[model samples]
Target: MRIIGGKNALDASSVHPEAYPVVEKILQATTSTLAELMGNNSKIHSLNAKDFVDEQFGLPTVNDIFKEFRKTGA
Candidate 1:
């Protein structure tokens, strides 16, 4: 579900070809990080979607995207 969302978002963004790998890496890392955080936590049933987004925002992919944007002025 998350991967599908990520891919859709990426597709909609029209990011540069060179940044595709970076974006994909970020998506994978974000998924794993969230999985690890949720691991074996039976008591945890609900989570704020914003919190997951906040975590992903801190990933290096954000910086990579910015750099790509700067390079291309896109």
Candidate 2:
């Protein structure tokens, strides 16, 4: 491997061939879990990302969001 650059930067290259098999196995395991959790709906998904944003992030209601930033607050 070669490392080059100043304190503010660096460059990179490919990993050794021997490491790919291990990475492939790890990826295979993750795919099955990902499929089960993220695919086919499978009778789940009662709520989604938008629901999370509305529930947790709490939409500030157009008025609440821009209110103070606008002349309303002024």
Global fold similarity of model 1 (TM-score) = 0.31
Top-lDDT structure, candidate number: 1
**C-alpha TM-score for every candidate:** 0.31, 0.24
Position 30, candidate 2: lDDT: 39
Error of 1 at 40 (Å): 24
For candidate 2, the C-alpha RMSD (Å) to the true structure equals 19.0
Off by over 4 Å in 2: 1-14, 32-74
What are the lDDT figures for the candidates, one per model? 0.40, 0.28
Candidate 1 lDDT over residue span 1-74, tens digit each: 12334533444344544455654554464553322422223312232223323433544545445333333212
Report how far off residue 74 is in candidate 1 (Å): 13
lDDT of 2 by residue, 15-51 (tens): 2333324323323533633223232343123323232
* Structure candidate 1, residue pairs in collision: none
True-structure lDDT of candidate 1: 0.40
Counting clashing residue pairs in each candidate, in order, gives 0, 0
Clashes of 2: 0
